[model samples]
Target: MDTELLKTFLEVSRTRHFGRAAEALYLTQSAVSFRIRQLENQLGVNLFTRHRNNIRLTAAGEKLLPYAETLMNTWQAARKEVAHTSRHNEFSIGASASLWECLLNDWLGRLYQASSNLQFEARIAQRQSLVKQLHERQLDLLITTESPKMDEFSSQLLGHFTLALYAAEPAQMKADLNYLRLEWGPDFQQHEVGLLASDDVPSLTTSSAELARQQLSPLNGCTWLPMSWAKERGNLHAVADSATLSRPLYAIWLQNSDKQTQIRDILKTSVLD
Candidate 1:
C-alpha cells in the first residue's frame, strides 16, 4: 500500500542487515528498523527472521518479492510517461534522406505555415531505420517514395512527381560528362539501369538528391532529380532524349495510434496531400 515502505523493505532485503540498509538509504539505523516494523504491522506478517547477526526472508516475504518488484517497475514507468506528457506536445517525423532532399522539406515548410504551434522533430534516415522507428512508435509519421508492405501501418498517396536527367551543360561530349547517381530506391535503380550504357556506371552515388545537385551544379555532371528541385535552380537543363521517371510519395502512420484522428486531420488538410 505504501511505496516508501516497499522501498525500505526492498533495501533491507537486499542488504540483509539493518545498519547496511540504513547506510545505503541515507537514513539512521533506528529509522530503518522503525520502517520495517511499521510495514510488518500494516501487512500483519513477520517479513524477516532475525538472529543475533543473520537475517533471512520469511515465506510471506518471499511470496511478496515478485509482486513488490512488479509494483516498483509499474510505478517508475507511470512516472516517466506522465512526465513526458506534461513536458512536451511533440510530433516526431522520419523519412529517407532522398525523400527529405526531394520533397519532404517543402512539405515540412508547409506544415509549419499551417500549424505554427505544432512542435515537431524531423529525422532523415534509411528506409529500414524509418520503418523500425514507426513500428516502435518513436516516429509519429514517415514520408517516403516507397510505401511499406506491413499492414500494421496506414499509408496514403500524398502525391506524384517526376525525376528527369539534368546537367549543368548540354551533353555535347557524352564521354567527358561524369554521372552522379541519385539513389531514390530499388525501383528507380532498376529503371535507370536500362537507360545507361552497359559500361556506364556512375562516377558517384549519393542517397540525397540535394547532395547530388550540389555536385552536379558545379561539375557539369548529369543526374536524375525531382522536377520541383530542378526548377528552382538556374544553369541546369534536361539532357536530350532522357526519359522522365514518375514516382509516388506516401505518408505513413501507425494504424491504431491514439493520435490517429489528429494525424489524419493533419494529412488531409496539409499541403502534402
Candidate 2:
C-alpha cells in the first residue's frame, strides 16, 4: 500500500474537501481525486460519501482512521530511526494541554538534561486522543489525570497537584462573577459538584486551563486552577474559603513497549516540581 495514498486520504478526511486537501498537499485536485480512487479501489470500499459540498467519511473510513494514523506514525518513526546516525533513541510522549502547562513541560526539560542520548517528541492533546495514540503505538508514554484500566498498559502515579478557585479580585469571587469550569477529569467533576452550589451554572466550560485563564481577566470570572500556576501570576488571587482539590497525575505506557529501557530511563528523570 502506498503511504502517499493513505496520506491523501487522511488530508481529505481532515479537510472534508478534495480541493482543500489538494491545496494543502500541494497536489492538483485531479491528482488528489485519483489517489483517493486508487486507495478505495485497493481497499474495495468507498472511504467517503461525496454529496456536493458535504463530504463525510463512510463507516469503513471511520474504522480505518486510527489504523491509518498508526501506520503513518510508525512509518515516520521508522524513517527517523533509520536516518539518525547517532546512538540516540527517539520516543514520543503525549499529554493533555493543561497537564503540559501545569506539569509535563518542566519535567520534559529535566528529562532532556538527565538523558542526553534520548530524543523526545512531545504532543499535547485530549486524554482520549492520547490514549488512542498510546494504544495504536503512536505514543511511547502518556501523562494524564485519569489512569486507563487496560491490562496492556502500565500506569504509575507521577505526582499530585492542588487546584484552587482563583479570580482577578477577591470581590469578583463572590456574587454574580462569571464562573469558568475547567474539566479536570471525573474525580474533579464529582468534587466540584459538592463544592459548588446546585444552582450555580458555569458561564463557560473548557478542557484547557490556559484557555480558562485567558478568559478569566476580561470576564472577572473564577475558575479552578493549579495552585502553582495561581501563585505564579500576581494578578490572580485565591478565593477565600474555596475548597482546594488535589488531583493525581499518572504516567501511562504500554507494558510490552519496545522502548522499555529508554522509557524507564526517561521516567526516572521526570520531576513534577
Candidate 3:
C-alpha cells in the first residue's frame, strides 16, 4: 500500500481543504486530487465528499481511518526493526525513571562494549507506552515494576525495588500531620503501600517521583525516591529503613520475538536469568 497516499488522505481529513493539504505535503493541488482519485479508484470507494471550498470524509473514508493508522504504525515498526540490526546492532530497552537511573546504564555497557556491532537504545517511558511499542514490535525487551501479565508475552521477576523515606534534615512537621512525597509508579501508590490517603501522613501528589522530592524542598516533608538516586546526591538521607515498601520488578519481552540470542543474553545478564 502507498503509505504516503494514506497520509495525504489523513491530512485532507484534518484540514478539510484540498489546497491546504497540498501545501502541507509540498504538493500541488492537482497532484493531491490525482492521488485521491487514484486511491478512490483502487479501493472502489469514494473517500471524500468534495464541496466547493472544503472536503469531508465519506462514510467509506471514515470507516478506513482506524485501519490506516494501524497499517502506518505497523509499517513504521517493521522499518525500525529491520534497520535495527543492519544500520546498527540494535535493541530497544524501556523502563521508568527508577530503572533508568538504577540499572539501565549497566546493562547498556554490557551490551555495547561487549560487541562492536551492538547499539543500545534506552527508552524512558511508562507502562502503556512500553506496551504499545512492544505491540508495534519496536522493542526487544521491557522492564517495569508492574506485574503486567499478557498471554503473548513472557515475564520474569528480575528483582525488587525498595523505597525509603529520605530528607535533607530531620522533618519538623508534627508527627501526625507529616508530608510524604512519592513517585507515580509502584514505589509509592501501589495498593500494598497506600500513602495517598493514609491516616499516618497527609501526602502530596506529583507526576514524577523526582518532583516529589522537589516539592519536599527544605520543608518538614518526605518523599519516596529510588534508593540509588538518593544515596549519590547526599543532600537527602534515608529517615527509616526501607525493608517494608518494596515492589517486584519484572523483565518482560514478547514470546514470539524471544529467539533473538543476542537480546536474550543481554537481558539475562542485565536484569534477570
Candidate 4:
C-alpha cells in the first residue's frame, strides 16, 4: 500500500541490517525498524528474523521478494509511461534490426500530431526473444518478415515479402550453374529436388540471413535477402532465374489488446503496401 514503506523494505532487504538500510535511506536506525515493523504489521506477516545485530528474511519475506520487485518494476514503468504520455506518449516496440532501420521509421513519422503522445520505442532482437517479450507485454509490437504461429499471439498480414538471390560478381552466376547455396533454416536446408538436380550440396551456409547477404558480395557464395534490402545493393546482382522467396509478414500483437489501434496505424504507415 505504501510505496515509501516498500522502498524502505527493499533497502532493509539489501543490507540485511536495519542500521545500514537507515544509513542508505538517510533515516535513523529506530525509524528504519519502525517502518519495517509497520510494513510487517500491515501485511500480517513477519518479514525478517532478527538476531542481535544480524537479520535474515523470514519465509514470508522470501516469497514476497519476487512480488515486491515486480510491484516496483511496474510502478517504475508506469511512472515512465505517465511522464511520457504528458510529453511524448511513447510505447516500447521491438523488432529486428532490418525492420527498425527501414520499415518502422517510415510509418512512425506520419503517425501524427493529433496523437502526439504516440511515440514508439523500437527495441531490436532476434525473432524468438522478440516474440517472448511481446507476450510478456514488455514490447508493444513485433515487426518482422516472419509470421509467428502461437495461438495466444495474433497477426495482421501486411503481404508476402519477396527475397532475391544474388551473386557477388555478375560473372560468377554468369560463369557457373552449379553455384546454388542453401539458406540456413530448418526447412530451407533441404534442397528441394526440383530446385536442384545436382547430387552436390551448397558451397557454404550460415544461420543469419543478414550475414548470408553480406557474404554474397566478396565471396562467390550464393545467398538470399529480402528483396527490399537486396534491390539497392551496389555490387550484388539478383538472379532472375531463382524462385522469388516471398514470406507473409505480419504486424503481430497479443490478442484482445486495445493498443491495436495505435499498433495498426504504425503498421499501415511503416510496412510496404
Candidate 4: stretches off by over 4 Å = 1-82, 85-87, 98-105, 108-116, 174-211
Cα lDDT tens digits, model 3, 1-273, are: 799888888888889999999999999999999999988898999999987986889999999899888887898899987887678767778887656665565656766666667677788887788888986798878888776668888777878756666665654322423456444465445532533355554456544566666666645566666676577666776654334366677777878884467656765564521
List of clashing residue pairs for candidate 1: none
Between prediction 2 and prediction 3, which has the larger TM-score? 2
Assess each prediction's global lDDT (C-alpha) against the native. Answer: 0.80, 0.84, 0.70, 0.70
Best by TM-score: 2
Predictions ranked by TM-score, top down? 2, 1, 3, 4
User: Candidate 3: lDDT of 213?
Assistant: 65
Per-residue accuracy of model 4 over 1-273 as CA lDDT, tens digit each: 987788888888989989899999999999998999999999999999998978999999999888888898899899987886658756777766655553555555665633555766768777788888988888888766667788988788877667666776674442354344533233444434444446765555543555655666456566666667666556667764566665655778988666877776666564663
User: Candidate 2 residues 94-133, lDDT tens each?
Assistant: 9877777767778889988898887788898878888899
**Over 4 Å off, model 3:** 1-85, 171-181, 184-209, 218-220, 240-243
Tens digit per residue, CA lDDT, model 1, 1-273: 888788889998999999999999999999999999998999899999999669899999999888888898899899997677556566778877877766777778787777665667889888788889899988898888897799999998877888888877765344556778887777667876644579877878888877777787567678888777788766677887577888988888889877786587568655343
| lDDT of candidate model 1 versus the reference | 0.80
TM-score of each: 0.65, 0.66, 0.58, 0.57
lDDT of 2: 0.84
Q: Extract clashing residue pairs from model 4.
A: 88-117, 89-117
